[model samples]
Target: MNARREGDAAVQSYRRAQQRLRDGGKDVSSEQRLIRIEDALDALLDGLVKQREQIGSGVAVDVAGHTLAARARSRR
Candidate 1:
């Protein structure tokens, strides 16, 4: 799955977990779990933004040991 799709899934998971906690009443452990989920979501979103920016700017992007660029420059 793509980053965007993964991010969406993460959001849905977080919402479901949050709703469950709310229905069951909050506890220390559950709150901690929620915090961790939120942190993961934030990190995923941040990574997506960075990837989009890199792609838009035509910068070289490293993926699995290979570099991809929008337009290759000729060697001088």
Candidate 2:
């Protein structure tokens, strides 16, 4: 999937998980629940990392192109 899709899916899943936990009240303190929360958090982080990587790559490319153009103009 694309970066935005992946990011949106991650956010939705995290929100669902959080809601489930909130609804669980005092009965969802099992190890499984903790594991689920941890997994959700990890997925959220992974999505954020992917989005940031895509953004950073684009910014870097733009900056490099601008620098090259500036140098070429100076040489002319």
Assess every candidate by TM-score: 0.40, 0.54
Tens-digit lDDT track of model 1 for 1-76: 3555545655665565555444533455767767766766665666566556545444332453243232333332
Could you tell me which residue pairs clash in candidate 2? Answer: none
Q: Residues 1-76, candidate 2, lDDT per residue (tens digit)? A: 3545545665666676566555555666688678777776775666567667657666777898999999999999
CA lDDT, every prediction? 0.53, 0.67
For lDDT, the strongest prediction is 2
Q: After superposing candidate 1, which stretches have Cα over 4 Å from the reference?
A: 1-28, 59-76
In model 1, the clashing pairs are: none
Error of 2 at 22 (Å): 13
